[model samples]
Target: MSLNSTPQSVRVHIGLFGKRNAGKSSVVNAITNQEASIVSNIAGTTTDPVLRPIEILPIGPCVLIDTAGLDDIGELGKLRINKSLDVLDKTDIALLIVDSTIGIEKEDLSLIKKFNDKKIPHILILNKIDKVSDKDILLSKSKKLVKCPIICISALNRIGIAELKQCIIDNIKEENTDFRLVSDFIDENDFIVLVIPIDKAAPKGRLILPQQQVIRDILDTGAMAIITKETTLKETLANLNSKPTLIITDSQAFEQVSKDTPIDIPLTSFSILFARQKGDLSELVKGAYSINNLKDGDKILIAEGCTHHRQKDDIGTYKIPKWLKERTKKDLIFEFTSGITFTEDVAKYSLIIHCGACMMNRAAMVSRIEKAKELNVPIVNYGILIAYLKGVLDRSLEPIKAKELLSVD
Candidate 1:
């Protein structure tokens, strides 16, 4: 993680998926102009998905993911196939590599269908074109098979590589642009206070990624960022010449911070801010209402984006469940998942509560939300759930332009 480099989560995630010995790894190495993955003649050389972050002319900072072959065999091969499919959840764009000599196979068609189902923009790459004699016939057959931008290239000889890169850039540009994090909330010279709690869960001697990113965004907007712990929030406010424009706190300290902060000043939590940045704010806010509908034996899923060393009073595993039990007075069943593992069987749970996805990209978060929507299961995040439990959900969301999302009593 370099200070000058962009984070992998924020970069455009480009996944390369195809069958065994389709030259997927070779294509990745060609595009990056580096040996990003193992290039072996043996089948299933890439057992796991490999992520390489690089900067190109049109795409800027992008993460290139080379995944295992789709046509792998046996039990271990099935596991590899599953892993390759999982990469689709975070892929903003895809490259389906086909060995020109072998032409398009059934497995390749299946990959195209998945790309269409996920609505992920993809390019069908005809790799090792030099090995094929009748290029025109192969091109014609491929066009009829999959209706996507198809490019012919020789990964070993570097033929058509430049055009392939430009095609990728064009598709990514057409997909979507970057969204604002906090610039929309503050104007130039406005003062924004961030109430960060210094507890055991807090990383030693430094702020977390969300806090750092918020401060950077505030500075980028020419606004002032006043950072203080929840313990010193009152004194910090007292010493200020005038009221701060807004106050943002950690979700764990929402109850105390909401009490100390004035009613007129807008207040929110870091998780809420991030929900708007990386996920759907309104949808998550609406999901908070599910808390009231929880039955005695209902099941809840607590999902975290990153896996960190847990402290005894960890907020996700301990505090949130305890708070929900007390607030709803239900003997709820809790299931937990951390890192990139998200269950596809979303209907089993009555509700899904996710952590602020600071470690995940927007594509990944949106994929999770879409899965929940398809299963008709309500999903909320840590901040909104905490605010709802604390009976200050509306007030905490006042700082954002999503007031219409709050439920009317």
Candidate 2:
């Protein structure tokens, strides 16, 4: 990834949803001025969700997701429909395209109900307006059903697309600028040490996403960041003229970094910082305590945000499970999921151990955490879980002021 290019995780996710052949693909092409999706007269042409990243002026970077029609049929069609619906979990803004010729159907209403139920900001669009003689009827019918802005557009002719873009910009709730990885916790001119290990599993010629983002945040706060390897961490600290404000390291080096650093200076890991930035810190802290309640044969789900080639000693599949068994001294069953494939039936799992989620947007990560909470399942991220297993969870959370959240009792 280029430093200038916007990361997909930070972009606004706008999803196009409705019944088949409702001009969803046409709307995508018209708005983007490119054949981003395949438009077809045949229903169910789009078998899966299509994602296109485009920079919309005023709205900044945004991702448009064109999904399969909801009104599909047959066994295979049902699977496609579920995939489209699943897009809602990460959808920041939704565009419901209704064919004006066909008017509103039960499926469209059901989609609207889901948009409302999820509290997702959305716009109701009546496409193929050129075919319909009476546009008022299309507008009136939808207005009665949904309490949202309704616009009529002819996607083929590129009409009303500018207005649609403006509506999307308007509906976008301003992000919390105050929220950051570590910048919010430190002040300008403060020295922050980042201990990154270049291991066999590390990506070639680049730092991972979480490390890159944290460095950027530190620079944004006008703070100084000193990068070093875990092997040279002790020497690097001794060389510093003054004590640094905080020391952040990769979770895999938590044991050594915590041991090498002085007790007065604060300490934490990159994954723990991301857990607070991407998901709920307090909930994850509480979930860490639940590790004590594990028993023999308890089923645990190990979930990752993105899929990658697994090394011999992968962190999620190999290291975490091993440490967990040793810590609890129990025979626990583990299931693994990677890259946007989290199971909805979360009740079956006794616990959910997730990755740092640097590859996923905050909305998607929060949705998973919320779903687990709704199912009464405990969810903890890789950093917090590893910190607890290392017997330094309290010290790891002290820098972020999250140690108080450990009072789950």
Candidate 3:
């Protein structure tokens, strides 16, 4: 990924959803002004969700997800429908395409209900308006059926395309604002220390996403970022004229970094910072307390945002589970999921341990957290859990001192 381009995890996610042959794909192509999705007269042409990253005039960078039709039939159709619904978890805004001639169907209504339940911003689109004789009457009927902003458009003929684009921009602006990764914590000329350990698990020649993003944020704030490994931390600190404003380390080195750094200096981890950036930080801290309540044979879910070959001492596959069992003194059952397979039945798990989610967008991470909350399951990320296990979780959170961190166990 280029430094100039926006990451997928930070982009606004817009999902297109409707029944089979409602022109969902057509609408996507029309709005993007590109053949982003395959359009066909046959039903269920889109088997899975197709994502297109583009730059809009007002919205900046956004991801347009074209999902499978909700009204698909048979066993395969059921699977496709489930996939379409799964897209809802990552959608910041949704577009419900309704065939003007046929009006809204039961499936479309059910989809709208889902958007309401998820609290997702949405626009009801009456497509194929060219085929209808009375477009105003059709749009008025749509407004009466669904309590959302309704727009009439002919996707094929490009009618009302500009208006729909503006609607998307307006709704997105209403729903979101800019947030910083680490710039808010420091000011111009402030010195920040970042401890990054290069072990076998670390990538060969590149810094991880979180570290790169943090450094970029610091530079953007006109602050000086000093990078060092855990072994050289003391030497690096001694060379600085004044004590650093903050110290950020990889979660694996929290114990040593906490000991080497002075008591007055604030300390934290990349994952902790990302927890605040990508998801609910307080919720994850509360979930960390669940570790102390685990029993032997309790099922724990270990989820990673990206997949890679597991080394002998892999953090997720080996290190975390081993350390967790040792800390709890229990024979815990562990299950794993990677990439886009997070939408599952989480009720069976005692707790969920997620990655820092540098590769995932904010909407996707929040959706998973929301799912855990709905199922009455506790969730924590890799850094928080590691800090808790190392007996330095509280110390690592000293910088933020959020209300939830104040009561952490």
Candidate 4:
């Protein structure tokens, strides 16, 4: 859960998926009023998925995801198409862009079927309406396949964009603003002890986004927030109330924090809340158990969404890999992939571990999770895996009412 009891990833994720040359990028640029993705007549200009976070007026915070063309040709095209379909896994809303002049084709219909199968809420955009003489015919044909609101627009001219956005706002099946953190686990003025280790890996001056977000959420809940490193946790807690409501710590410090904090107080890591925020928490909890069954020599893929240059000891590459190796004792041939390299071929790997993904949108995360499930591979995130390796994964999920929903044992 979030610092305020809401999931960490409560932002809405909207994806634009359709065949190439159908103005998918143009539509995204039009909706967002910025050059979010590159547009070209080329069949496969967009190879990897592109994501942009925006605050639409009256719609709140949302992430827009742009994917490759589904109708790409050749061997490389097939891979790109697979990746585009992968974006659908976590998409809360899908915008199907259709070339109004050419009308709906088989490729567009395939995406519609997939969206239906995923049960994702979607909208149909009849793009390039200005280039068509018979706009009526296009609208009539599209209504048969998708019953959602259809907006006719010339993305090049910015027509119907406001209406389209308003429709998106109206279609939101769920809306949450108060989005709180773990404060609900405590009393009005109860204490929430946050254990943060000032390791070399900690950012130069500022706290990481997750930690900062937690602090803000705690303050928002009118609770007493005490932050300290592992060395200061014991003394800090001892100086506080007889019982703090909840204690949250970075997964990397789980073992030390667990050893220091008494069991009566509820505890969990930043990752457990993130798992619920960015992906499916329950499914990941279930997947975490499969880690125990992992044997030596098992192939594992540790995935990171951001493509930034690594520091001396990067968490995704150096830290997690070393931790897994030490715990598993298996000569595991681990592989690492970046944002544009995620694929659904998990059959060859024993497990897949990902990061917090502040750089990636919710749709992309969902897509990766769905692919791992399709390959029948156990997938968990950095926070979850770190807590598990630290031997305190259980206490980390204490605030979740559904923590009992999945027993890792």
Candidate 5:
């Protein structure tokens, strides 16, 4: 990942969805103007979701996800279909492609229902319009069945691709573009101190995603960021002539940083900042309260947004679980999941502990949090849970004092 490039987590996730042989791949290729997804006459050519990040006109950075057909057959096909549908969790805008020659089918209608159920803004794309006679008839039937914008295009000939792109731009909600990591509250020219630990677990010679993103957000706001390791945090503060606005540190170094920083100065962690930016801060804080209710034999799910090489004491796999067990003093059953693989069957787990989600988009993180809420399962992220364990949950959250959402008192 280049520092100049947009991170996938911050880009608008546009998903192309439809049944097998519905020209989903064709729509993707046509819209991107590149061979982003393999297009073929064979059904289910796209078995897994292919995500390509590109800058679209007016919309800026966007991720187009081409998924497998929903109407697949056989046992293996079922799994492929499941994988394709999982893309819905992170999809900001859905592009439902229908073969105009065949018209809308049961599968397409079912997909529309899903789009409505998820409340995801979607556009119905009628592909292969050149092949179909009486395009108006197909359009009439589709408009009657699906209550959304419809556009006809011949992906093979690149006809109406421009209109489709315009439709996508039109459906982009304001909420999708208004989110900021930490720029909304901070002012320009303010000095922000970032304590980044360069340990073995840290990526060699580069900062982590959350750290990089926070610095970028600060710089975008015209604020200055003073970067330092935990070992030099005290000296960095002493050398500064003016008081910094706030101090943000990694969750792993929360205790030591808290001890070094003054009580009057605001302090927080990168993970906690992401809780408000990427995930649900209020819901996560409530979940942190549930940590005290853990009993023996309870099943807990520890989920990380991205997968990485594990050290002897990885934060997600080792430190978090160890701290949780020691704090609760219970024989809890732990289930771990990393990357984009989040178990939909969350009822089996008493609690869901998620990472900071620097690698995931807000849509994906919100989807997971919503799922847990629907099942009445408490879900907290790594930073919040760590603060709870360190007995500084309230102090760690002081930087973002969202009193309406968090009842830290």
Candidate 6:
């Protein structure tokens, strides 16, 4: 609840995964120095993934995810493992806690394979080391997984706490130095007009996270943000001392913004920034062409990154669906799912339209896109679709490498 918790918990998601009674809860408590999870002999007590935001010396600010035991039994146990696997989607660094007494497990191997498939970097924690006589043997088994850094720790005794923190710090991937959010798009100190139209779909009395983030990012780069509604966009530009550096607008109002902003100044949308920031921009740009492939009566899935109650005219549910139907001139069958509910079942639809995903880490958003690709389904986001419909997708996506957009046609 304190501001100090924000830095460590806001950026990274450290997921603790292992079989039942494998010291997952113990490790969580040890790292956080709190009895965050109930340590128990009873299996499957942690029904869902328990999320605790904590700051550690090594891992910085991150969310500690304690998953239900993967080895749970019965119908309830099945639900537990499913929940654990679902937690994998948000995991930035995975700590595979293995009980030294158990040595290795089928559940451990399966969890490792899943992490490997997702390219998630992980380490092995040989927990309850106080109970094991031969620590080397358990570590040897862990090395077979991915040259996993195996640490001997006694959560009961608080031994190796510093060592575990160091291991976590070693694995955290700091943001790349080469990446520039606003500077990459325009020169330094450039003034950019931001068109945020207030509508019924807009969150009541507050700007959405992506818009706020983009505004902050622009200011962070020393650029000026001239925020206004689409209605005032034309007049605001007229009053500026010079042509504003560029224009960024919501995908929902891209058409109006593009028309109001004169030609020559680069124009794009917040959704495009997300395509680059959180999701795969290149693939989505290419997928934009597929919108033309849609026929009347085809099905499309508009998925939101995080679940929240929608206003009367929610962008994903109301505006996008209606826009798609109008653009295609087809009675398109539209289905809506919010949060991390996407699955292999989406193969039945003609297309999948995702949100800007301001709330999700870049990795998880890309992973969802990869799964959609594996199913041979075309998945685009709300921004990309709006850009495509407005006929400015290329202009919006100009920052991406040319070769990446070569597949756009």
Per-residue lDDT of candidate 3, residues 1-409 (tens digit): 4423777776788999998899999998998898878899999899988988877765667888998889899999999999889888888889999888999888888989999998889998989999999887877777788998888899999999989988888787333434467787788999999999999888999998899989999999999999999999999999999999999999999989989999998899999999988888889998999888899889999999888899989999899999998888999999999998984689999999999999887778988999998888999999999999888988888787832345444
User: Which pairs of residues have clashing backbones in candidate 5?
Assistant: none
* lDDT for predicted candidate 6 compared with the true structure: 0.78
- Candidate 3: lDDT of 186? 84
For lDDT, candidate 3 versus 6, the one ahead is: 3
CA deviation > 4 Å runs, candidate 5: 1-5, 402-409
Better of 2 and 5 by lDDT: 2
lDDT of 5 by residue, 29-144 (tens): 88779887887888878888897877776777888898888999999989988888898899999999988888889998998898889889999999889998898888888888
- The C-alpha local distance difference test score for the whole of candidate 5 amounts to 0.88
Writing each residue's lDDT as its tens digit, candidate 4 over 124-209 gives: 88899999888777788788866777999999899989888987887765522223445445556777888889987787888877
Per-residue C-alpha lDDT of model 1 across residues 276-331, encoded as one tens digit per residue: 87867778987899788899999999999999998777888899999999989999
- Give lDDT tens digits, candidate 6, residues 1-409: 3545342214678899998888888898898898888999887668888888776654445778899988889998888788889888878789998888887777788888888888787888888899978777767766776466778899989999889889888876664111234556665688988899887667778987777777777777888999999999889988999988778888888888878777787787888777776656667776667877888778888887788877777778888787777787877888888776765586787788888777777667878888777877788888888888878877776645422433454
Per-prediction TM-score: 0.94, 0.93, 0.94, 0.81, 0.95, 0.90
TM-score of 4: 0.81
In model 5, the Cα lDDT at residue 280 comes to 73
Question: Which regions of candidate 4 fall more than 4 Å away from where they truly are?
Answer: 1-11, 19-26, 33-53, 65-90, 130-137, 156-158, 172-188, 308-315, 318-326, 402-409
Total colliding residue pairs, candidate 2? 0
| Whole-model Cα lDDT of every candidate shown, in order | 0.88, 0.89, 0.88, 0.78, 0.88, 0.78
Pairwise TM-score winner, candidates 2 and 3: 3
Among all candidates shown, the one with the greatest lDDT? 2
Off by more than 4 A, model 2: 1-5, 175-179, 402-409
**Deviation of model 2 at 125, angstroms:** 1.3
